[model samples]
Target: MSFMKKHLKTLTIALGCSAGAFYLGWQSPTLMGDVFEQQQVAQPTPRFYPLERFIISVPGKEYQHYVLLELALKSSSANAKHQLAEADPLVRNSLMKMFAGKQVDELNKPKNLEQLQQEAKDLLTNVLSANKFAVKIDDVLFTRLVIQ
Candidate 1:
């Protein structure tokens, strides 16, 4: 009985101290100030830029033809833009090969345009893996994609 009484007193005192500390903390402006500071911190938006939509002419067994591709460039940071400096030919080559892999029907299907876009995004992710400034591809838009 005595032990229980002693332990109860100790526990009660500990809980009271804890509650008081928490209450004091809640009543202070420091937490709100910290939150305000956090909100004020500037964060950069993802840098997204236009990619050249080009028509690729590949000589095939049947005949020479043109394949159109629409592409967009994205980067997590602005440094990616500085690193890349300008438009790149390698990026175009990678995009062309990716477009060539798709069937003519797949490219022409308007319903699958989203799928094609996501595929292009994934392709960019893969191709830009080795770049100094990592780029996140937003989408591939084909302004004109006609193979003739």
Candidate 2:
């Protein structure tokens, strides 16, 4: 009882300090809205550029197979999106040429599909760069793929 009484002030001071620290920490972020606003201004919203549906003929052992692919390119600027749109003819032709000789069996596998997506992104990025489009394709997304 005597020891508790002796340390009560110290404990009270420690608790008060912790509570004050927590309150300041919680309030600091709200006080710094300008910092957050600057961050938001620095980062641009992402954009997606979709290619029209692709239907390509793939070589098969006994019969020809058709692949239907829905693809979108992701970038950080509208300029990239506009560039892709302007070069739609070249883009479609390049992708069609890439997909033309692929085997149906290869497209059927999940691993092959992933590889195909990466390869397509690389090819498209290269083609766009070669054509003097100042945009980088960050990713290639396949929303729908069918091999039949």
Candidate 3:
């Protein structure tokens, strides 16, 4: 009882300080809205540019197959639309070449399709970089994919 009384003031001060720190920390985000606003303003809005439909010929063991692919390029660049417009031909050509010679059985699997999406993204990035286009592709989304 005596010891508790002796340290009572110190303990109260420590507890009060801790609680005050917690409250301030909890409220910091709301208080820092200006910083967040600046960050949001610095980031560009994501844009999607859809390319023309692609009709690719896939070779099989005994027969020829066709893949109809309609995809869009996602980017966060301000001028993505204009850059993509200028690089459209090269983009289509690269993707067509990549899709060519793919086996039907290979593209039929879901896992393979996901891999293809990543591959397409990388291919587009390369094509844009090589062509000196100021575009950075974030993803390649397939709006329509048909294997016939």
Q: Which candidate number would show the highest TM-score if scored against the true structure? A: 3
Model 3 bad stretches (over 4 Å): 1-41
How high is each candidate's TM-score? 0.60, 0.70, 0.72
* Candidate 1 ranges with C-alpha deviation above 4 Å: 1-27, 30-43, 57-65
Error of 1 at 21 (Å): 10
Local lDDT at 86 for model 3: 86
Better of 2 and 3 by lDDT: 3
lDDT winner, 1 or 3: 3
lDDT of 2: 0.87
For model 1, how does the per-residue alpha-carbon lDDT over 13-58 read when each residue is reduced to its tens digit? 9999999999878866675565434456576677666666787765
Please report, in order, the local distance difference test score of every candidate based on alpha carbons. Answer: 0.67, 0.87, 0.88
Q: Residue by residue across 48-148, what tens digits does model 2's lDDT show?
A: 88888999999999999999999998888658867887888988999999999788888889978779889988998899889998888888899899989
lDDT of 3 by residue, 37-104 (tens): 44544677798889999999999889899999999999998889888998888999999999895788
Q: Give the clash count for each candidate.
A: 0, 0, 0
Q: What count of clashes does model 1 give?
A: 0
Count residue pairs with overlapping backbones in model 3.
0
